[model samples]
Target: MQTKINKVELRNLEFDDYKELKNSMVESYPEMVGSYWREHHIEKLLSIFPEGQLVILVDGKVVGSALSLIVNENLVDKNHNYSDITGKYTFSTHNPKGDVLYGIDIFIHPNYRGLRLGRRLYDARKELCEQLNLKAIVFAGRIPNYGQHAATLTPKVYIEKVKRKELHDSVLSFQLSNDFHVIRVMKNYLEGDTDSKEFAVLLEWNNIYYDESPKLINLEKSVIRLGLVQWQMRQLNNLEALFEQCEFFVDVVSGYGSDFALFPELFAAPLMADYNHLSEADAIRELAKHSEPIRKRFQELAISYNINIITGSMPYLEKGTLYNVGFLCKRDGTSEMYSKIHVTPNEVQHWGMTGGSKIRTFDTDCGKIGIMICYDVEFPELSRLMADEGMNILFVPFLTDTQNAYTRVKHCAQARAIENECYVAIAGCVGNLPKVNNMDIQYAQSAVFTPSDFAFPSNGIKAEATTNTEMTLIVDVDLDLLKELHEHGSVRILKDRRKDLYEIKKINT
Candidate 1:
């Protein structure tokens, strides 16, 4: 009576499924007397090796499970029994630093037996083995039909017959079909078992595709040389002068061998200076009209310099609504746009700007990176989400009119670096825009920050410009050092996160 396994979902075992898992195991193997796995054993296995446990659901009902643990090759001797490898079913021998995956148990409920659910479980184990880069999978396979042949054949002879397709023992045939070869046989592997006559066949599945070579640390891809610009504001007579100012900075930074150059938030505000005669709202609207041309010029500059450029931000008008947008232009001429997700009260009240709804990370030659405009970087959850997506660098472009505002941005940027274990580079406007009404009297100092640990700078500041100055600060950040900090630093904040207790997940509409 095989049930049709429509809508089967394979997922990691959750602690909430402990009761169902135990019930399924007891119901599926009722023939073995006194061979019940208690809840404490499952809890211990999950506490130590949760990644090795998997469960299968058919139409929203738990139907099967596969349990495994990692161990060193030395622990699995050629003649060892199941108890020696599994620590008497308590799985106390599970090792986090092991190189081989040892199968503990796999079972499918009786109602779902012949629908090939076991094959799906086995395939999952193989995938997990490859993903963890384990050298092999070793398990003691039960020979359910071996008792009938035990009087006439030895375990080795029985396995040989099974391999040659002359014998059809269910468990051995399935393992052989899945590329497992019998290493040897073990006696007294499990107690009170009519199956296998209290003997088990040792099977090994070698990962032929596993690479044993040492991984070379790529410094070229791991190190990003950054150029941070504290842009100065001035009265603009025309767009040509604005282009010249941007070109000057791009040329100078590219000449200094910067892999990526960052410009301050609202660096192009001076372009709005020419529209002072109009109302403040009208002036911002006029500024939005130049977003396209400005983006094109930035792209050209990025291509000419052969460096990635983060164009602080520009006022963009789309579908009669304005948004503050930043353009990340790469040397290859491809660009991504990040709209300001957190709009300031001033922007909403005065300019009728709306906040962006989406957040994303960009894949670049250097590494995964994220862009957060001034107010967006102040939020911890946004940066944490980016960090979860493997972002190594965060670029922030800001505009502040007072020292207090500048300090807030700087402190928050540094905090994001420390909490997320990532590099944060902040660039801002430093000079005044007397002609512009709402954007006058700028104060800023640009800085690059790293995680606060031994792997990074002691002060957490990689390079900082003089306060209230128009300057470019250049620094080289090691991305490899970030990897080390995340894994083995003073505190592994990323790895130590309690995902079961609380998680920061994105909701999709």
Candidate 2:
């Protein structure tokens, strides 16, 4: 048997490909044989708007298709059905001067399903919708599997379940996953569509970059207000006290509607004052014991306060070795850990801390972010790796005991913001722990940084806390500005990288 190479590409559906298109359509909806689209229908659509007729070709053979046509949203009512929108099979509803792209048909062959070809087709439609300056991509999406649950569930309830991920519809599920939302449940959408039971969903995917009026930039989700907590070293009698103080700051940050609430690296070290009598290494391990419970409580605080909390950095014990790690507790009740990629000499000597092995970008409700603990921010490679992953902000939680040490983290982090063209926020422990060894003294001036350009602050420091003071510095950083700077800035290091001479790739472990 000869080895067959599978090559997949997308192109406009041509009139000559009508036979294979009908064949693939029937493979999914066999009950509607003659009722499906015919050669004349394909020729008519191609003649009217050829770019909207997209087909996926695998090994030079058409396997799937996404069909769409422009429609004036003002002329059509929201209650319109499939036949009415398709102009009684004549497609008279297609308007060249329209505000929306009305999706009419989509189908895939059984052998080519699950390859995400539908997403590619949807993307092509979205690109065309944006390029044509359309307001949105509107479609009547079929709930074909609604018949299975119609005996007990209503169409509205079924759609709700699908949106909540409690239920799945072959078509609607895929659409919802691709950012399309249900405007409402549509009825009598198609004739003799048994699987759908004559029900459909009015779905829409808005184009963010659509130009209604001349503007500098257009983005719905951009600005992320952050609150950096410059935590103090205090005498806490128990673990609850530490949590209470942390919760208070979270409350304040959340009250101001900040997207992120960050604490200092080892800010919870005050809890380790209880184990001060143990050896330095043993005490760090004891601090590791509190990591699990604190992560849990911070997660609760994140949900209750409705703020994302970076729990700074703490000692993490795995197997027999110890590592420094931070927990990013998102308001959605999920916790992610970012271990320090590079451990300091003092940490290795005193706490038996080893560097972590994995690093990846974090997806938050606000935007893509990354966490690099104290010493990790000093290395340029880590932040560059994060920038490659489209990181909008980088959080550095440090615990430098000397003013020089603090300056090292501060200067390098600022450099990262300039070079990566992303925001950088740093918070660290202030004051001192009288009892805890190797953690006796600390210094930090929590600050938020921005790319050094005309759009940003002159010094690139958005806001900064008073030196070694326990306070939260609240600042709103415009992610839209970063997008603008990435393209047209004084220096474009990311785009100007000499990829022909060098490249950076992550090695899989």
**What clash count does candidate 1 reach?**
0
- Runs of candidate 2 exceeding 4 Å displacement: 1-220
lDDT at residue 308 of model 2 (Cα atoms): 91
- Position 42, candidate 2: lDDT: 87
Whole-model lDDT for model 1 versus the true structure?
A: 0.87
Clashes of each: 0, 0
What is the C-alpha lDDT profile of model 2 across 1-509, one tens digit per residue? 11453698899999888888887787867767676688888889999999899998888878889898899987445588888898988889899988899999888887788788888998899889978999899998888889999999999999999988899899999999777877888888887888889988999888765667654643335788999999999999988898889889999988999989998888888877889899999998988999999999999999998889999988889998899988999888999999998998988888888999998999887879989998888899889988999998999999999999999999999999999999999999899899888889998999999999999999999999999888889999998788768755888879889999997778886
Off by over 4 Å in 1: 1-220
Question: For candidate 2, what is the lDDT?
Answer: 0.88
TM-score of each: 0.61, 0.61
Which residue pairs collide in model 1, if any?
Answer: none
lDDT of each: 0.87, 0.88
What's model 2's lDDT at 229?
A: 93
